[model samples]
Target: MNRIDVHHHVIPPFYRDALAGAGITAAGGRALPDWTAEAALEMMDLLRTATAIMSVSTPGTSFLNDTSAAVELAQRLNDFTAELRAVHGDRFGYFATLPMPDATAAAREAARVLDNGTADGVVLLANSNSEYLGTGGQGELWRALDERGAVAFVHPAELPAPEVEGVPPFAADFLLDTTRAAYLLVRNGIVRQYPDIKFILSHAGGFVPYASHRMAIAIAADTGRSILDILDDFRSFYFDTALSSSLAALPSLLAFAEPSHILFGSDWPFAPVVANQYFANGLDTGVDAANLAAINHTNAQVLFPRLAGAPITTSAERPVVRLRHTTQRAVARALFKLVQPGTN
Candidate 1:
């Protein structure tokens, strides 16, 4: 199946200089990954990936407190991606980075990127330094995304100070931040307010599958409020499998959300190198084929029609029906039946 990976990233040299100039390093103290487009494409080629929509890495835009520097950095990253996309064509598209603390500038940057057609849409931190981003000053930016039917890749940013056990910062805290943003967007009426923009959450929708009951309870406790109202709005959001291809996580997602909304992502060029192995190996997994390919590539194309180049096809394109989940024996039988010359 041809796949259009919507959650891949590219950290250009200018961003490295910016981070180093500010003495900033690491993500939650983990070393910052050294990202390059060349290595990214190599990984994609190896994975049979057709195209990847690139976003700037974390601590970007967020680290630059100076709005001007943030603007300059964003422009540089956007331009760099434009050049990459130009060279690679649709195989490499980009989501724009914005200067967020200053919402006005953020809105301006969104316009600059989208209006110029330099990017497909915008990529924003889910939580801007500890607070949930709702339909507030950020609304100006959302409005632009909504107006253009743009793709908004909402990656969870640095979580609040508290870190829970049994799950490290990246696995637990980052995932928790993602759930928090999902809630803010759906239950808190942000997604309801801005329905036009497509929202893509990272790491398999974070803690949503585990914590969805809590969300239901939150709705029930507020009995006066409509129950399960947010579920519909949430269907609008997408999730990527990054650091979330675990036995515990992936199964719950299959149980909870449909595979059509789960996309594949590999945060590459991880500084230590061993990390990238973990990311790539997760793909040759045991998830059901229809759903797995959808997660890997098909769903992304459905969401962003512009990514039509992905080689995979979905039930959406054909009259074929798919089973939600099935046993390995059944899949093997189906595979055998399809390969037989006289099966028809």
Candidate 2:
């Protein structure tokens, strides 16, 4: 299967040096892994991944205290990735980094890279300096992305809360962080408001498919909106199966997500090659051939039409067997009771 990995990460030399200079040698409670273009290509070849959409992972530009420094680092990282793509155009694409929480600077950077074809899209951390994506004062950034009809990859950052002793943020907290951002986007109407910008949620939307109906109820109660309408908005976000392609998670994700919204991801280098292979194997065994083909590449072609260099087969061309709605709701209800028993 030729897959398009939307969740691959890039670690530029300057980024590593900057982190080292700041006495920050770890990200998401893990030591940074060495990376190179050759290695990434080799991994892709091993996994049969035809293309990788690269982005800088967590703590993106947020580690820099100065707005100018953050902006500059984002530009440098983006430029470096663009150069890589220029050389290996068929094998790689990149999502530009933006210095968020500094909304104005982020907006300017988004325009500079996206307008000039320097990026396939942009990557935004779930939160920057404790300011989440759907929060206020980010109208400029949203508008800029919306105007371009850009694809924004929503990656998780370290949680704002204090870490549990001996627990890594990426293990569990990252999921919650992405879920929080997705909820806020739907709650605050950013998903609906910025209709043009396609938001790709990493790590299988980080518990979103499992908890969506429950969240929809909460949003409906707070906003006086229909739960079905809120759920529809939640479903609008794209989901990439990165570290989340296990057999246990696939059913809920495949059931809740729109057919074309599920995309393949490897979370490579950050996820380690062994882990990537493990999950990729799980996905291979969990879904039928046709559905697997869609998650691997066909659906991705619809989003990134430029990747349609050869004859493209879409998911609509095959028969997909999805989990019944009754089963999905039963699972959701069980999970809801376990998580929040007293809720209506």
Query: Model 2 over residues 125-149: C-alpha lDDT tens digits?
Result: 9999899999899999999999999
Ten-residue region with minimum lDDT total, candidate 1: 313-322
* Clashing pairs in model 1, backbone N/Cα/C closer than 3 A: 2-311, 2-312
Give per-residue CA lDDT, model 1, range 104-213, as digits (tens). Answer: 88788888878887788788887775656673566777777788887788877777676555454664677777888887777667777778788888877888876776
Backbone clashes in model 2, listed as residue pairs: none
Q: What are the lDDT scores of the predictions, listed in order?
A: 0.70, 0.88
CA error at residue 134 for candidate 1, angstroms: 1.3
